[model samples]
Target: MALKQYMKTLSCPPGCNLLLDTSRFDNANSKLVDVLVNLKRIGQVSVPNTDENYAKIRQIIGNTINDPSVNKDLIIAAIMKTDAIRKRRGNSARNRSGLGDVFGGMDTGMDYGMDYEQYSKEKVTNKDFQANFTVDIEKEEKIFGDKSFGETLKDAEKLGAANNDITSIFPTAKTEEKSFEESCPKTDIHCAYVAYMENYANSLLNFKDFTQFDGKWMIARDKIAAALLHLKSSYKGKEVMQPNLDNFKNVCRKFVFLCGTKANRERSELVKSAIFIASEARADKDDLEIHLTDLFGEVKASPTISKDAAVQNRMLGADYADSVRITGSWRSLGIPSRVNGAESAIDYIREDNDVHSMHAAWHQINNQREPRDRKRERFFYFHNHMLLRIATERASNGLPAVQPMSNDVLHMEFSTEYNIRPENDPEGILDDYNSPPKTCRLTRNTQETLRNELRDLVRYKGLGMERFGHHCEQNYHADLHNLLMKDCDVGMLGYFAVSARPPIFYRIHSEINRVWHDFYSNQRYRRQDIYPPYGLTIRGITLHSRCGRVNQAETFWEKLGTHYKLNHQNFIFRIRLYNWRRLREKVIVRIFMGPQNARLENYFEMDRFVHQLDGNRLSEIRRYDKDSSFVFVKDQNDCGWPYHLMLPKGGDKRPIKYRLLVFVNDVHDQRVNVGTHPSLNNPMCGSNRQNMQNAGLELVDDRRDYGFPTNRRWTFNPVPIVNNRDRYFGYMSSIVNIVHTGEETDFCNQAYFR
Candidate 1:
């Protein structure tokens, strides 16, 4: 009876003329199409316009004339079977719950309103509920020869009610070819590229906002294929490959813009990850291009060096026919040279070797002149080269080289310009002040000015704070607030505080860290704080989790989701401080976290607080929690980028060991009037700084540089640890392990009950 009911469900509903008298329609193909169209309209069959079956059915019905042998009933049965198979496939794959199970893999359970206790108590037994119904097409045609469609449908319903199984009529379900790539036949690279784009578009079907761009992607894919086909005729060797590859990259970059911008951060991050994967695919093609280029020589004959022109100008000091002989040359090497190197007339005098030297050599080879300001040029050059090296390395390693939509070639503007009105558009959507600046070629003089500005940024007291200071810090409170809150371009890295969104942020920091590493490796050997002059000491350090004490070999669960992550456990620090000062005095509680074996660059800023004390107290206890001055954890309202990364990934085998350092600074001497903005006072660190700033909220919590307590140059005499243990930068250390989340041994779980 159930099988008959399933078969009845596949057929058209009442008031269908095709079911009344099929003999009137001589063509079986036409009759089948009529039934299919009715079935499609009523939601029985879900055939999207893009489906090959939909097209095939349309073609057969529109073109077929008198096909005597073809059975329309069999075709209908096949369609029904295909639809069921697809439904089953999708149901099995879909993840209904964020917990990873769709429906607990059962027909009925607690999720579907069944009482868990009663259902569990009942004996689980397999019931033989199978049924089979047979359809007699000849008998049906004869019986309903002259019946009306409504009468025929009623008879079929009655037949369905009478039968138990309908295996003979429905046919077996089989895997249908639903993908466009399968239908299109990808025989070559062009077809493969087109298929890749189509697959990407198909993957975004779940996302409704991207629907408008789906058709555009198909059009672009076809356009790319056409362009490649046309170029194949005229271009020779690898030359043709270059243009097509570039075109594909351009298309990918164009699509990437749909993701980036001051758009919603959560959605944007998802789009970005997808675009990054697509861009990486294109970058892989670049490697193929390189291989092909190596296989084939240049498209044109190579040029030879000329000897006759400058033969008479052998003397270095003597003037030649071309008197000024200023043989000047200029070249562009992407933003690297344009921003901080020779193309921009900015140069750096190498202090110690880093990634920048490679770029300096590149500039020299290109015959570009260096900037006049030595110290300023060196700072810009080092940082510029450092960032450039990161991008180049990512490219070489087959990763996305820049932000998802960083291509300069394909730029688009809304037909109606978006205006950021502070009154109505508080998020600054129009001006996109949170976004990186869109700049054209900078003049040589402007480049020099930018260089000087960059130099000014890095010269700030602390290495880690240099970039933050120039962009958001150091500025007067009013000016900094304006820069952070307003819908202007001044908030971008080269210009503002919105550095974290772009990939260059990490690279620039890596360079800054490299500088610190060099300073520590060569200049300073001992990494402990030594202060014999001041009567202050780090009594002891303790790491506290929600449970009690954090020990080595602990495991913690990293909260993972489709678009977000959070560490299951949060920790607090308990620091014991001893003040040797007999009179009233204040000290800065500087805290940091680092790899047990690495340099200070890898160190994360934990917290910084100013502590005041009266006449000689031997010891003072200070407890720190997530509410402290430096911790930034993700929440429903705030978008903290990489805040989840603050907690290191845990291993199943052994607990992750980390070093905790606590050092103190005298409030009197260490005080620097780091100019402030509301951004300088927020505890949560994330990419949505501009979002908060535009809303006129604080972005960062601390007043000094981002890495305040340990940010300054560590030149103080080393402090001896009471026990034999590792030390760095004059800070007392404790080795602790972050336990895995939701573990049975973890006492933190008991908090839920309490």
Candidate 2:
């Protein structure tokens, strides 16, 4: 089934789309032939007789590029199958001779007996070469200024300037701009850089490097394969799959280091551009179009802006983010504004190494009273407030107010420091230390230290404490709160302004939650008033998909560039509630999806709503209702469900079963601020359309505990109870198929999501 799905995706052999014809293989260029051979070897597709083969090869190549995790055995099997087909057809091509001929045979082990030195002399000359690729940093610096391009763009924000004022800081925006393939300029730097880097990283696609046509290419391929396998086998969603240029650079950086290949200085230049381009592309809309050349200068991608689903999917979805990030950019469209460089100031502060450490020196002694130290502290403190502020605002916006980093990641800070060797064991058998002792060592108490600072930021004596007031009361005792909040295990959350990908962020937050749970479980609710008159009841529940009602759905692993992530179709719920009161009353509704046998604590909180039903009316909330049930799931957090684990792992024999539960309580009522925006009533439960626009930043508007309503220490029993827990309401059962490979077939598309 996986193979069939994969075959269906192929329009031509992977990497053969540039060549277009198998007869193109009848050439003097051994590099081209080697590429053809490698394609058949790795992809196992027969040489094409028609355009369909080109599509198939192109798709296969794309799949391999997006998922370097393709199994070697599978490739070997495909090659063997292709070889069998060739043998059945007779070895006509294999009998060819002379330097100008096609490969002698399809044998994987054969060298095809070509004089590579002669081939290089003939093909690599200036006259023979179609173009020359080089980075002119001097020209770039002269045109754009020596300052970091990102820093220059950021000046507009600092000056409180509008979008049009960008020219004041960057005069080059007004100058004549070059085409896509031209050298980097102030206006086109991001696109040029990304193009270069993408070309460098995906050098395998073009086979442009004649010197590496044989051995190094194969080695690089194997190393990438191994790296991808390692990443996927130990799959944790911690490493982001957003196709951000930095993420791509990081992945490529890892591969380059692990494969023992020091990228040529020229190649590194291209790699840098690739990173920038990929990032900008992923952040933009899918339909946004651009024209750009791949590294080989052979494949030109010009996606048409169209609404046709078939055309769009064929052109974009194969490696959507990957393709767009490289081919689509503001520069690609001839726009000069710094749309690609406009990352939040907070993001820059967190990601820049020097800035991160300078800000991290809050606990250090030397500069305890220095003005710079104070500034650093202010910076850190400001972001701490910002994170809590966003969380607070998100809570007010009816979205999840939990620090996104709460899932499973531990953000230990590390820095490369130099130390003199002790002169013991000079052979260097003890470590992979660079030089003597300059090594990337973990900062001592990195998490704990940051956590303490964060805790201080949240406390009464911290900066901007007045905004939180007494509402900052967590149920934990002061000492335990200090202990849990200051624990060093919280990496990204501890350093709130820094880069915190959601998965690991949630992990650290979960640990903190566990600590809080320990303290909360020990406390007792002294005043338990049984107000049966205020009893809230769930009237009925139904599962929904775009097509209509459905009880089962499938979640599958979808490839996104070099990574695989589980894709889920939006499943809606139509939940009915009865106030059972004659007077209008505001109540909190909690929804959970979990195993029937699991404890309420383990139940996944899917959605929450704060509703004021009309006097004694049954309020019906739909699945797409952000105010009542929906919070847009991004590449990272899914409100409550982690995308990778959206569906339970069921075998080929059966689907995983789960129970959906709904409960209502008045405990959250006192916590709600009256006259707050009616939209903020479900605080961090539902997000606005604006929030979706800035989803890349993963920003939210809420200031609340990571686990809000459920985190409360109070308990109450409701009518029509299902779980034995003190507060229970009702539940429904459902099942789903969990597969390794499948396309998004659900009604949820960009339109529904938007």
Candidate 3:
């Protein structure tokens, strides 16, 4: 019956405008072959005249169409039977090189010489057939004009059938392979450097010869200079390297001493050579130099660690040292960061290294200034939030909560004069020996500089409230945090993995948050402007779990490691928006969450983005927790905040009370395109970077800052403003509570939340 349904969908041929009648063809094996011949006559299928191809086709039909266990095989045979009628009519010169030639002379190892009787009698497993037919179905469908045929052939080949000759019946276009040099853009020094390092790291000469140099820094330096000179001469006129050129050079200088005693130094030199060549060839020297200074000046000032154990103990836990070493080596290849066809710029940022040298290198190389900076700030906030939440959960679990390292402990008083303050100094001794040298004891001049930046960030009112001044203030605070910590070592509060695991990172971010609150506290918003435009009203917001509506949810830790898990129940927010204007309109929906009865400034942004409403009607919007804009759905090795950590870990003794706020505002400029990737259209992970870069060609996903209402402080009480005034914002006060479930509970199945 499934085969019949599949056959019914097959078109007769181009211009025929008719689907095949499955009723006309019987289910008999010979009848199926007759159908294939008829299909070939009508130009649908393309079966090679070779005996081996015919035998494989007959075996596939005999094995699948008659067997109940192999429905997929039947579909394949049915598609091929119908496809031959359409494909054979147009091309008389179909390639007849058999299956070997179709698979680019690769041996399929199928016994095409087997007789039909023996082949039919022997049971062909799907796994065995798939192993032999390894052609990509999508690629095959483009060539054969039948997706089912491609799928079936792939399946049949996997089954223990002599189906290797199937491809010879329908030839596919060959895709051109791109070389590393050709693939890397001339102006992207980062791309070239990564590519060069990948090659150097994997090469035999680098491991055998370069490792022999050991502590011979002088000999290695000369060899590095020679390599750089060669690289410069080779691509002198066509390449431009910037951003991470200094990092590349620094890695070279540190070499076997800092990075490793093996070939890592040589590898670094090779990468530097590529970047230098690219920069000298086409880059503006002055601009490149300026960017290097602005971005990587800290890398130069920070001293390299002589011991891997020290780095592991200081930045990450000593237990993670092995994992870090393994992961770092894997990350250094930069294979994960390489852009694929469907990946946008934001996608690259999400997948870039979270730890190791590559983390900083990734940002420098993929130089999309606005998106990079915006993502950087968002990442900082999100990461810190994760740390704080996890710490809360740990404290609930009877584990000690991570404490924030204070700046005062380091004698970093803003009024102090520049002086050398050592760790063991009696007057100003520092306790955290693990902190980066610069951060442990700041000179008086450095203290003054940091103080000035913080003061400016706190006092600044921004351009104006009318033009996203709140966002400007928020970004300014984040940027100041980066500026303050620029001189810190790369692994210590500079990169994600290391920073997230440290107490000092929280201290720095807490300071930024303090400034952000100060900036927003001084700003005023007109009640009229805060109100939703175009007569749109958010009717109400409700929370629901898998079982039913719920007022509370539970969170627990997964069985292993620091990973926490939300109760299995999938939580969703159902929002109803009424459009009183009586015309279709776009509106932005901003969601914020905070501790119940807490000050408005304590709220944390949950999700914010533009959503459209039906004209003259109420539109119902359902948002799932997994689809939060701040998290990424699991995709390969992509580095994102885990989805399970979306909710805060509740208290063990009592449930943690929280408020859910939803705000709706009318979109004035419809012309501003906020689009997402065609493949991954979810607004959950934020905007697509490529779309933002090519606004003319593709639409951006979202234009709002990472945090909306929560990005700024509120002078007036929002609950009253939303509820009492009948404004566009819908306030669900004290709607949700998070309880800490000490045991491993699968909430999705057990209905514990309900």
Candidate 4:
């Protein structure tokens, strides 16, 4: 109460006083307590000033102050109950009770109703969470680093002139003497880079705000804290240490904890790390400068050099005149597929006189190639290359580089205005990705599966296949190739191209890889809250789609409908959209379940877009307006651009990592039976087995019927421990060469994930 009284009695600043107006003072009850708490936090220990602050509060509470020592709890509670003091203060509009933080705006009291108890139960430990961030004590030792030892001695000389304490931490330095300017940091980036890394450093104290220590977010914070503490302790215990270094390390650690606990030391240390490079340059008498490089032009023929070698090459200077390079020779990092695929692709593309191959590397190299084909490989190459690039970029940004020391090759393929934005299309309706930023590798089985589905559609219905410019009886087929997929030795866990076009549906691959960089990174090292970070095994992808325009030249409504059945029980939350030309202008989103190709499905939800013929106010659209969006329609639009969004996980979910498309119209089951043989037009055709009947398509004995690869853990030998101690970062159960000894042991960092 006295704190509030002191605050009000003190005159506020002339202007910029937003809280004390008429409307504000009317709601003063909410403001008094908040103001009192803030004032006590900055300074002013006792209610002792009159003309200054706390003058009135002293007079009012003088009697109480003289009696005895008062605790903060009584003071805070008494202040909040002060009605007379409350009316003097103002400003009330809070977002919600429990939502806002109570002290210093740190949300410790309440959060978004997260199940803390459940989260804590699920936490694994520090060793399991090691894959999350790099926490090395040697790295954090930089906290004690400040000015050169020589500069510190000069500052000591200046301080030595004054009366100094005989018994100090740096007694030897005090005796030796130093100057002020000399003691100050010189060529020391510690202070200069503190603010740069503060936000990241503070994230380590995430526990102060969030009650729930979800393993990933928690370990990432604790390991950093551990690293900082180790640095601090080392600095303090140095018997012959500089006092300046100890103070610097302490302050640096404090500021870091103030920001957020979820930041990594690698990012925080980068600026200082660069400064070290600059220091090295000064020592070497080289150019005292560093320049960030920009990348452009085709990258498939990228100049061959390691990352470090690339940096050195830049330092030495090289003219990449008339050259094309792909940023990296490989898409993946250390995984099996990455290593294998990189080697395979390199050999294929490196063949001499493959000049035309540079333009489109993925399609022609992976599958069939024909210049006259309608669904041209070049078109597919450009589109898929775009997907590959985008996915790779996202992956590169989020996760650390596995091939940190390797040089990336230049990309040979190029796309004009490389984007899939709907505005640039000749047809307002979208099409398959011609050039995506990144591409995913598919299994031979998945590729063949799609082919069979398309073949069956072409053979039985004939109509849907006809629209795609393909025929079965006469033998002419659309120049068909597997959709946007790159071949790799280290393949993906699962990648499905869910186009409503032919048998281009299910894609279940083996290995740890992804098209979108986001998932690609996820497959490697994601901060998954439940399991320890290691490997991701994708089961399969259910590709569903629907043609929105409904302008298919060959519409076989009946037989096509029967062929679209999915026996997989995970089918729900299906929606389809169609742009009815005859209908008045309207934006609509429809939801449906059951068969993906059901003819008589109910339109769950739709909203008319145009109130008047056109209005400026209605031009802008929010994400909630699902009608105009490319999703909710059968599409070749199964590409993840600017962002890789997770398929619907119902309400609260870890995102359906795989994609699923729900389509309408008949792109399947030909009415006439055509013999499965080499026809006049159909030169490259294969029939798959019929037992694996998905929809009405007759599967051919092609390459798409293989099981996905698994990381065999049973081959590892048992980690025998005579003393019943569990090792950190241990993999006992089902390890390839490691045997399991089920043991009960206590763990310190058990709350984090490995």
Evaluation by lDDT, superior candidate among 2 and 3: 3
Candidate 4's TM-score reads 0.20
Order of all candidates by lDDT, from best down to worst?
3, 1, 2, 4
lDDT of 4 by residue, 8-112 (tens): 433331121111122332234234444542334423455321233432442344234222233222232224233123322332112232221322233333322
Runs of candidate 2 exceeding 4 Å displacement: 1-510, 524-535, 546-550, 558-564, 578-583, 616-619, 625-654, 666-709, 712-720, 724-741, 746-754
Task: Count clashing residue pairs in model 4.
Answer: 118
Task: List candidate 1 stretches off by more than 4 Å.
Answer: 1-505, 512-533, 546-555, 558-564, 614-616, 633-646, 669-680, 683-731, 741-754
Which TM-score value belongs to model 2? Answer: 0.34
Cα deviation in Å at residue 261, candidate 2?
28
608-680 in candidate 1: lDDT tens per residue?
Answer: 5655556664665455444444333322111111223344433333344567777665543433211122223
Two-way TM-score contest, 1 vs 4, winner = 1
Q: How far off is residue 442 in model 3, in Å?
A: 4.1
Q: 102-181, model 2: which lDDT tens digit per residue?
A: 11111223222222233244311222221111112222232223355465435423322222231221222113232323
| Root-mean-square deviation of Cα positions for candidate 3 versus the true structure, in angstroms | 20.7
Which lDDT value does model 2 have at 395? 28
> Candidate 3's residue-wise lDDT over 451-522, tens digit each?
554455444446433223334323443333344354343233322222323334445555544544454566
